[model samples]
Target: MNFRIISALVMRYLFLYSRSPMRLVELAFWPVVDLVVWGNVTVFIQKNTNPEFGSYVLFFLGGMILWDIMFRAQQGVAISFLEDVWTRNLLNIFVAPVRSSEYISATFIVGMLRILITAVVLSFISWFGYAFNVFQLSWWLIPFFLNLMLFGWSLGMISTALILRWGLAAESLAWAIPFFFQPVVAVFYRVEDMPAWSRPIAWCFPPTYIFEGMRDVMKSGTMNWDYLGYAAGLNILYLALAGWLFVWVLNLTRKRGLLTKFATQ
Candidate 1:
C-alpha cells in the first residue's frame, strides 16, 4: 500500500482507541485480578494440600500468565473490530481506499503491540512480587511470548472472520476460545493425576508444550528445545488451518448474503 494510505489508516486506527480509553483500562483489570486474586488463592491451596502442590501452583501461574497473553492478543483485535459494529461505522471505514488486507494488517499490528506492552508490564509485576518468573534473564521470554501471541492472533483473525460472516454474538467468541487450552492447563494438576484417557486430549493444545518449555527453562535452567520445536510446528499447522477456514467461511457468508445479515455496519 502507498505510504499516504497506510499512514491515514494507521492514524484512523490509533485514534479510534483514543476515543474510548475506558476499554483499555477495562482490559487491564482482568489480568491484574488474575495475578493478585488467583495468585494468592493458589498459594493458599498449595500450602494446605501438599509440598508438591507448590510446584503445581507455580506451574499453574506460569500457564495463566501465558494464557492471559494469548487471550488478550486475540481480545485486542477482536474487540477493536467489534467496536466498529457497535458504532455502526465499519461500512464507512471499508468504503475508504484501504483494502481488506491492509485493514487486517493494521488491526493485527495494533493488537500485537497492545498485547506486548501488556505482557511486559504484567510479567514484570508478577516477577517482583508474585514469584512468577518465566525467564531468568528476562530476554529469553521474547521468543516464547512471540509464538504464543502469533498463535493467538491467527485464531483471533479466524474468530473475527467468523463473527463478521455469521453473527456478532461477541459472547460466544469470549467463552469458547480460551477453553481450548483446558487440557494444557490441567498439567498444573499433574497430567498423570488425571485419567489415563484424558492425557491424550490435553496434549492436543500446543500451548501445553509452550508452558512446559517455559517451566523447563525457568525451573531447570535448561531449554526443552524439542517441545518448543513441537509447539512451533503445531502453530504453523494451526495458522494454515485458520487461514483456510477464514477464506472458506467468508466466501460462504458472501454466497448466502449472510455478510449483510451480520454486517458490522
Candidate 2:
C-alpha cells in the first residue's frame, strides 16, 4: 500500500474524466433525470387529490436519493476497472509498480469520491427542487449511507472479478449486477410487503435492512440500532468475500494467461 502509487492511479482515472466532457456530464445526467422524474411523480401523488399519500413523500424521494448512492458507488469501482479494460490499459497499470491491492484501493477511493460528489448534487436537487432533505434522517444517515457504500463496493468488486476472469465478454455485469439486487433490496417497497417467498432472499441483501431502517425512522422519528447493526454486519461479511473473490480470480486469470488476452483484446 504505497500512498504515492495509489495517488498516481487516482489521478490517472480522474484525468480520463477531465478530458472527456461526456464522461463528466454522465456523472450528473442520469442521476438528475431520475430525481426530476421521481420527484415530480411523488409530488403529484402527494397533492390534495390523494390525502393518504402524504406520508409517502419521504419514502419515495429519500429512498431514491439514498438508493442512487449505492448504485453510483457500485458503478464508480466497477466502471473504473472497465475503463482500463476498454482502453487496453490494464496491463500498463498492473505492469507498473502498482500492486493489485494498490489498484483495488485506488478504485475504492475513486468510487468514494464519485459518490460524494453525486450525493451533494442529488441532495441539493432534493432540497430546493423537491423539498426533501435527506439529512433530516439525522446522524443515523451516516452509518446507513456508509453501509450502502460498502455493499455497493462489494458488488462492484465482485463484478470486476467476473470480468477479469471471463474477459471482455463478461463486462456487462459491471452495470447489470446491481439491478439484480435492486428488486430484492426493497428500495421503494417494504420487504414484508413482497411475496412471502422473496422475504428470505430480500433479507440477505445488506441494503434491505438499510432501506427498512429508513422507513422505520420516517414513521417513528427514532433510530433503529438493530437494523444498522445488521446492515453493517452483512456489509463487512460481503466485502471480505468480495475481496477474496477478486484476488482469487486475479490469480486464476494470471495463471491462465488471460491477463494478456485482456490486454490484447
**Residues 1-265, model 2: lDDT tens digits:** 8999999999998899889988878888988999999999888877855666676766988788888889888988899999998888888887888887898888888888889888999999989998888888898789878999999899999999999988889888898999898889999999988999999999898899999988888878786788888899999899999999999999998899888888779
Candidate 1 local Cα displacement, residue 122, angstroms: 1.5
lDDT of each: 0.70, 0.88
Residue pairs with backbone atoms closer than 3 Å in model 1 (clashes): none
Q: What is the alpha-carbon RMSD of candidate 2 to the true structure?
A: 1.2
Candidate achieving the largest TM-score = 2
Question: TM-scores of the models, in the given order?
Answer: 0.85, 0.96
lDDT of 1 by residue, 1-265 (tens): 5666656766776787677787667667778787787688777887789787566577667767778788877776676677767777777775678665666666667777678767776778788767766556265477677777777777777777768765766547844676566655453555566788877876665666767677676567677678778778888888778767766776787789776656543
RMSD (CA, Å), each prediction: 2.8, 1.2
